[model samples]
Every structure is written in C-alpha cells, then in structure tokens.
Target: MQQQAISTEQSSPLTLSVALQVVSAIAVGAALLFVVGFAPMDVAHNAAHDARHSFAFPCH
Candidate 1:
C-alpha cells in the first residue's frame, strides 16, 4: 500500500491586520472610558461611579 504525503506548510492562527484592528479597538474604548468616566462634573462622575458598581468593579 502507498503512503500519503504530509503537508509541510505552517499557517498562523491570527493575521496581523486582524490583530492590529483588535488592539486599536481596545485602545480607543479605553480612552473613551477614561475621558468620559473621569469627568470633573458631579453628574458625570456619579454616573460613572454607579456604572462601575453595577458591573461589580471596585471604585474605592
């Protein structure tokens, strides 16, 4: 019986462009949260604080 040949090509699990897109999205989201969540006004601060508590994130 003849044996089948095995392929030697190596493939990446993730492409570079996709990885960059993911990183960029995360960075933008973090920046947005930082800017809006840390506003000086009491209303904005309270809203962000309450949101953190709702998500079980420690603010203190």
Candidate 2:
C-alpha cells in the first residue's frame, strides 16, 4: 500500500499574482471607462466621440 503525503496548510485559490492581476485589470478598466465612457474634458470627449462614431455607436 502506497501512502501520499498530506499537506498541513491549505492553499488559497486567489494567489498574490492573481490578486495583483485583478487589481491591475480593474484599474485599467476604470481608467478607460472614466476617460472614454463619460470624459469631462472636451478633448477627451471629442476623441472618444470620434471613436464611438467609428465603431457605429449612436450618441446624440
């Protein structure tokens, strides 16, 4: 009979690398949403508006 070694510590599903990636992705998404979705500045809004038109997004 072969016996396997049992781990005393439990492994976490959300590791350090995964947590960092999640945070970075959230930051990037928030930045994009803020800059493009509803930009306060005119230049940013115009740029995003052009991009939306290019993508066929109807924005009045």
Candidate 3:
C-alpha cells in the first residue's frame, strides 16, 4: 500500500501577498478621492450626509 500527501504551504504566502497589495491599493484610492475631491467645507459636508444615508452610518 502507498500513501499520497497534498501540500498547500507553498501557495498560500503568494496569495496573501497579492491580496494585501490589492486592499492597500483600494484604500489609497479612496483616501485620495475623498481628500482631494472634497476639499471644500460644503462639499465635504454634503458628501458625508449622502454617504451616511446611503450606508446607514447614523450620523445623527
């Protein structure tokens, strides 16, 4: 009788690195757009109001 083994240790690290890179990119893009696109006080306020309602963040 013979036994076979499967290995996953080699592929997980590369997958994790790629996932982290993608998340970092999305975060950077969101930050840049929010900061640069909403520099004015009124614009920022309006955007926040809309976002709060859309996402149900509850700003009160």
Candidate 4:
C-alpha cells in the first residue's frame, strides 16, 4: 500500500492572501459608505464647501 502526502503549498497561502484582501476591501468600502451615506444634506454641503476652500476652488 502506497501512502500519498497532500501538498498545500499552492492552495493555503493563496487562499489566505485572497481572503485578507477581500476582508480589507470590504472594511474600507463600508467605512467610506458610512461616512458618505449618514451625513445630512446641509452637513455634506458644508464639508464640500470646506474642502473646496482648502483646494482654493473659488466657489464664492
């Protein structure tokens, strides 16, 4: 009877790397969505105004 050894060299690292990347992407995306989505209209406009002023966009 011959016993065969399983090699996980190709599968394990690749799977872990992909899983980490996916989790990280989801986390960052969710944070951005929360920041953008939960803002009131006036607050959002004011933040944009401040940003524009910082960049010297001349909104006035």
Candidate 5:
C-alpha cells in the first residue's frame, strides 16, 4: 500500500495576504540593500563603499 501526503488548504484571501506580505518584505529588504550598497558616507555607507571598492563595483 502506498501512502499519500495530506496538504492543508488556505483560503484565497489568506493566501493572497500572505503572498503580499512576503513580496513587501522582499521589496523592503532589497531597498535597504540598495541604500547600503549605494549610499556614501554614513553607517551603512561603509558597506556600500566596501562593496564597491573591494568588490570592483561602481559606487558612483
């Protein structure tokens, strides 16, 4: 006998909300990284500068 896996179903509304939240979080994180990788002369600025200088990426 073969066993089948059971899956839990989420309502469409709940699924959409969760998906939106995940996408929003990803966007926020990307924005933060862009700032950190492009902003010059600040706290996160160091990360940006290093990413450009040591990593051979343009900071300008």
Candidate 6:
C-alpha cells in the first residue's frame, strides 16, 4: 500500500482589506465609547445592579 502526502500552501502577508476591517472595528468602538461617557467598571456595576433588582424592585 502507498501513502499519499498532503501539500500545504503558504499564506501571503496581511493585506489592506484585513487592515481596513480592523480599523473599522476600532472606529466603531471609539464612537460607541465617545457616546457613552462611563467607564467599563461603571457599566458593569450598572448592569449587575439592574440584573439583581430589575425583576423584583418597583421602587428603583
């Protein structure tokens, strides 16, 4: 019985298309952060607080 070897192809350098995708993600994240002035800690705190009380508390 003969075994066949698999051929592996080498990839090219990172192109402009990939770079533009990364830039778009960064730009969107920056825009979102600019609109929301709170830090991640504050965001997490608020989310946690809401999750803990949103279902049971009417006075909040």
Best by TM-score: 5
lDDT of 5 by residue, 1-60 (tens): 011111124345666656766676787789876776766667766656756677665655
Give the TM-score (vs. native) of candidate 1: 0.43
Best by lDDT: 2
User: In model 1, where is the ten-residue run with the lowest total lDDT?
Assistant: 1-10
CA lDDT, every model vs. true structure: 0.58, 0.61, 0.56, 0.55, 0.59, 0.46
How do the residues 1-60 of candidate 6 rate in per-residue lDDT, one tens digit apiece?
Answer: 011111112244546445655676787788764434333456644655554355443222
Runs in model 5 deviating more than 4 A are 1-12, 40-47
- What is candidate 6's local distance difference test score? 0.46
Give the clashing residue pairs of candidate 5, or none: none
lDDT string for model 1 (1-60, tens) is: 011111113234446545655676787789887755655667766778877667665454
For lDDT, candidate 1 versus 3, the one ahead is 1
lDDT of 2 by residue, 1-60 (tens): 011111213254546546655666787789887778666777877778977667665554
What's each prediction's clash count? 0, 0, 0, 0, 0, 0
Every candidate's CA RMSD: 13.8, 12.2, 12.8, 12.4, 9.9, 14.5
Give a tens-digit lDDT track for model 3, residues 1-60: 011111233355766656666676787788876654544566675667766556654444
Give the range where candidate 4 is weakest over 10 consecutive residues by summed lDDT: 1-10
Where in model 2 is the C-alpha error above 4 Å? 1-14, 50-60
